[model samples]
Target: MSSPHIIVVPLPIAGHVNPLVQFSAKLVKNGMRVSFIVADYYYNRVMSAIAAEIQGEEDCHVGLQSQVKLHSIPDGLGPEDDKNDMPKLFLSTSASWPAMLEKIIQEINGSDREGKVTAMIADLHMGWALEVADKMGIKGSIFWPSSAAFLAVEFSIPNLIDQKVIDNDGVPIGRQTFQLSPSMIRMDTEHLPWNLNNDLVTRKKVFDFFFNIGRALKLTNWWLCNTSSELEPAALTLLPNLVPIGPLMTPYKKASRQHLSEEGLSCLNWLDQQPARSVIYVAFGSLTFVEYKQFQELALGLELTRKPYLWVVPSSVITSTKFSNIYPDGFNNSLRKIVGWAPQQMVLSHPTIACFVTHCGWNSIVEGLCNGVPLLCWPFVAEQFYAKTYVSDVWKIGLAFESCENGIVSGGEIKNKLEQLVSNEDMRERCSKLGEMTMKSIQGDGQSSNNISKFIQWLKE
Candidate 1:
């Protein structure tokens, strides 16, 4: 019989796309054929990522590449659409994507030689795909690429409404603390993912987008998350449908020396010469926009640490006219390296990385924790605050930064946090212990490994 075929989709962004692509690789490895689809706008980037990941797999597994097909559908966006504006991009795609995806699935199903698609696994952000999967009589699942704790909060929206913590529109009714269960950590109202946006209009639009995601989630036959039971015991227990079958990072990916760009290779080479546990790795994700003054403060702050640092500054900063001229007066290039991009999984796996100074994005949190690197959390917006809460408060593996009244994290504050993070033996030990447990979760007989086996069996059955 032909192997079961699965369709996979992801929101067109680095964090979202990377994991689902890796997950596609996993599906292919388990004797399933996969149709990996993306918006035309991100096709090239996604293809590049897939190629990089493939380069690291074993020779025996090389043939698996042929099993995972790549397909693209136009997002109905034009040249004039500002793809960088996430809310607008999501709102636009909501109108255009469902029909586009439906057409793609029809083509796949109609193919004479290809195996019929038995299921679809998509990023939760693209939840509407689940509805489409239902229409086609295929099993539908949504992958939560972030923390299960984050998923728990989103899944509990109805409960939040009943408790009057949030209104029907998903806006906070007051400054209140919420917990999916009493055993879980309480999160603040202001830090709720949708409430972080200062503009009410934008906030409502973002909330409504997620609200629609919640509606579509009802159609899911399986709700998979890129996390482990070891990391979020309470949240997983609370949401029984939330299966923890990840770190979704492939083992080949964890150990791969492959680079996405020349700049990334250069960053790894520089780390090679640094002392053990001495380099501070800093990367705010693709979506973070650092202001010019804050950028200056960060540069100065890394300098203040008097420790070697490697910072990944994304391409979005290229438009900042003053970005090039913001380094400290005595900034030594030998000790401070900035790259346009860095192969993050490789960088985190390096021996020289002492701690990560991060924006607390869920992907970053997972990578840092799995690598046993301590963190100095500097959250910019959205669910990052909740992620930081877990990092600093629940897991006790990291520390949070306090911004000044002006919202700039001063150089001194950064330096102090670095010192505190590095010097705390207890935190370092906790980080190491948690990292071991997390990495083990994906290995043989681990919780995540067992879950993945069960999921594959279900798909085949």
Candidate 2:
């Protein structure tokens, strides 16, 4: 079969975009034509990036450079749009969806690209775009950005409601314990992804968002998760047509983290000074935010560890509140490494690192696992809590923090978990074994590689 032209829809968020961008390069490598639908805000930048990614290659034999195209979708953002608030940004995106759909349909019908527009690969957040493929009589698939467990839970929403574990609005039924599947972790109702615990209005909105996804996902022909089956066998097997084809990453992505080399040089030097596997590395992924008090507690907690550490507190934390003064005495004297935003993959791959104190974002977990580092799991929001369960309970590669009612993992708790994780030789050995297995799964002809090949074949068909 000849290579097919594929339309890819990506959520504008960084986590979603980063992996899909890498996947697009794979499709190009396999000699397929790709039209990546991008928000105008990032169009030129993405175009340049992807173009550079395939520059010397044949671009899947389409031409020297014509195989990949960037198509823009208005995100309802103008000079006046409020970019600070995400829900408002989401609402603005909802306003633009219909127009985006119409434009894409028109583009496909007009037929300017090569091999015909055969399929759409959309970020799961853009599940509604499946209708565009349906109207055009083409295949549609979802690129889920998080764990397969996250998708599995969304698939089981109906059962969760029927079991009286959660209401239609997704509020839990009076302190009940609910399992999305019998094999998965049993979770407290208040900690469910749709429940923010304290904010009813935002929680309801998130619930509604998932309610739409639960329906929208049924229309797609296939599910492509950014995880490997070896990592989450139960969740990967839970839903039909769910393909775990990832941790799809370039092995040398860390070598490219040179842009942050200067801010992180001192940290690297400090890591060199520590004994092997003796330092704790703390970084919450990009999107998470702890309240100022929690931030303070976390800072002090790291100090109490009395162990050398590298912590990447996003600069935004300091913007909202000055947390430095709140840190306990002797905090800076133990010596700081990576004050704000270190290159995560580099830090994880470092020999001096023992336990990763992480927010349990799927990317962070996978990276840590690939590097053979056990985690001190402190989940913040959404599927991160689910990831925490799979990490600590299911995968056994991590130790979870006991959080307070306010959802805060206090300083004392942090110190306790860090001590235990650093002291646990058995867990470190297990993490090393799992990391080796994860690497094998993504190598040539392994599960993820095979699934990706099958997905590409499906595109051609």
Candidate 3:
């Protein structure tokens, strides 16, 4: 039998693209031919990372090339010429998706490749892929790229609204606290992540998107998540045909440039001198921003914990000249060291790293779990709150801190949670066990591997 040919489409973002790249590599290992269709702007970075990873593999060759497939789509809003303007960028991308899909399908159909385009795998955020696949008569699967438990919460939003547990606007409509299904974690309007409350229109748009996703469930050939059933079995039951294939990472033994930032190596060397399980690794995923005051508080908290640590403080967070004063008294000189960028996977996989003080981004959560590092979850926005719920409540592998009255979490609270996660032996033991399970699920003969194979087979048929 000939190997199946698949085209994996990823949203043009670092967090989204990296996992799809890993998944594509896994498909190649399983004897499939793969092509990645990515935005022109991100083409070079994505291909470079993939090329670095596959440098020595003899039989497995992963092909990557750029196509101007989605340039015409308008994101219901005007064109966002500036890449740095995040709000306009996201809106423009979302609006442009429908037009982009039409162009991509045209390109694929006209290609000289022998086999017909058999299947389409898309990111949930790029919801237009379903429509494109339907028009092309190709099987379509939506990859949640998050925990099964988090996806379960998203799928349950309509039901929650129907029960008046959440308002039509996705705000908690009633005062009585109610838990969302599958994961069984409590939900409160005030506890939602930052995106839920920043603006009414934005919140509504997000809510409507999820609601549409829920309604389109059956049209989806399958749902794929970057999690294993062992980590979220209860949540898996909520969706009949869900595939969990991840903690997808660059191969542990391979020397890949995918994680090699300029400062990454230096950061790892610094971590080497810290005592085993004594360093807290702090990072927010790609899009989150930290205010100067909050950044200072976090620095102070780490200092108070008195643990050697590595922090990925983005340049934007330290732009203010007064940024140094944001930390606790004398913290800048008191701690071991701080760096602007860190080799995240290296730090998490290191023996000296005790816990992750994270913004609870899905990719970071999966990486932390794969390395068996416990987490102190402070979810800033987006699906982070859902990820936090899975880590703290469902998995019992981590803890969450209270957000302030204004829904902002302060450095003092961050300090308290970091101390608790590192000092508590029981939390450590549970995280270690969960981490082991997470690793096993992604290895040979594991449930995640098996399920991914099955999902591919279904796609072929």
Candidate 4:
């Protein structure tokens, strides 16, 4: 008998691809074969992310890559195309991928290679893949790679519309605070994941995309989420098919830690010299563009912290039209080190790291909590505001930065938040306790582990 085979598709973003690939590695370790697909343009990135994810999985690292086949389909974008135009990328993939995926499915089933494909799993953003799988007679599941609460809010879109929170165009009725569920956080209409963009045209495009996802939700029965019931009991309660199977990370093993880039190693070495729990680690994920004014404020803010810090400001920031210069003038200082990127998981797990100053991307949120590092939330857009709510309100493990006039989180505000975050012993204790629970959920017979076993059992059957 051949090992059960599955096709895994993720949206072509680092946050989406990273967790899904890490989950694919989990499937590989459990005696299954996986066909991991990415856009042709992002193939190298997917591979790099996979290499980083498995770096700590020493016991399974060698054979793991072999079990998971990497497949790339054309994204219909050119070498010089601006991939940062998200609406364009989303539409391009929708236009080009379905047929390509169908072809790939046929080719895999026809081969003697990994046996007939048994199931398909895709990122929630790539919901249309489930339809392609259904046409080919395979079971399909949608994977929500972020917070379960986030998905719950998305799932409530129809309700929001019915309640006149928003109309058919996804334009909110007015400026009002609303909660998807009584147990969930109250959010401003302006902060609705699809409504945050100031440009009406782009906002509508994004809202339409998510509106279509609501339609796509009906096409599948299984929804795998990268979270645990213990961590989000109220949120998971609202999602019947959304199984909790995460906090999926490269399990930490001190001797097996490997840095994927030289920058990562250098950053870790800098952390090594800092006093334990005395350094602030700041990183906004791949796509966050800081405005020139905001960038200067952030740079100066970090300087004001008067403590050792590691800030991962991608070098590309210097090239953005938003900036004439990426750093504040006369900003040369030994208290900080700036890098293009850092091996995030490794950095979070480092002893000298005191707090995470983040943009509240869900991946960053989970990683920070998993390492027991409290966060200074600096949300920029979309579901991030809600994520901030979870960290600072529901979880009580972090604090959100307050912005003054003109929406600038001033240097003093940043410094103040860091000071508050570091000094709150109760918050630190809560974060540490949450981290232990998060780690446990993926090990032994914890809820997440059991959920994974159940899903695999069903797949094999």
Summing lDDT over every window of 10 consecutive residues in candidate 2, give the lowest-scoring window.
55-64
C-alpha lDDT of all candidate models, in order: 0.82, 0.75, 0.69, 0.83
lDDT of 1 at 299: 87
Candidate closest to the true structure, highest lDDT: 4
Looking at model 1, how many pairs of residues clash?
A: 0
Over all chains combined, what TM-score does candidate 3 have?
0.84
The candidate that achieves the highest TM-score relative to the unseen native structure? 4
Question: Clashing residue pairs in candidate 4, if any?
Answer: none
Better structure of 1 and 2 per TM-score: 1
Comparison by TM-score, 3 against 4, better one: 4
Per-residue accuracy of model 2 over 256-290 as CA lDDT, tens digit each: 33334366666776777899888889888767777
Error of 3 at 303 (Å): 2.4
Order of the predicted models by TM-score, top scorer first: 4, 1, 2, 3
Tell me the TM-score of model 1: 0.94
The pairs that clash in candidate 3 are 73-96, 74-95, 74-96, 75-95, 75-96, 296-326, 296-327
The digit string of per-residue lDDT tens for model 3 on 310-336 reads 878766556634544545565665446
| Model 2 stretches with alpha carbons more than 4 Å out | 1-3, 40-74, 77-91, 101-116, 196-202, 253-275, 322-331, 403-408
Ranking by lDDT: 4, 1, 2, 3
Q: Count the backbone clashes (under 3 Å) in each candidate.
A: 0, 1, 7, 0
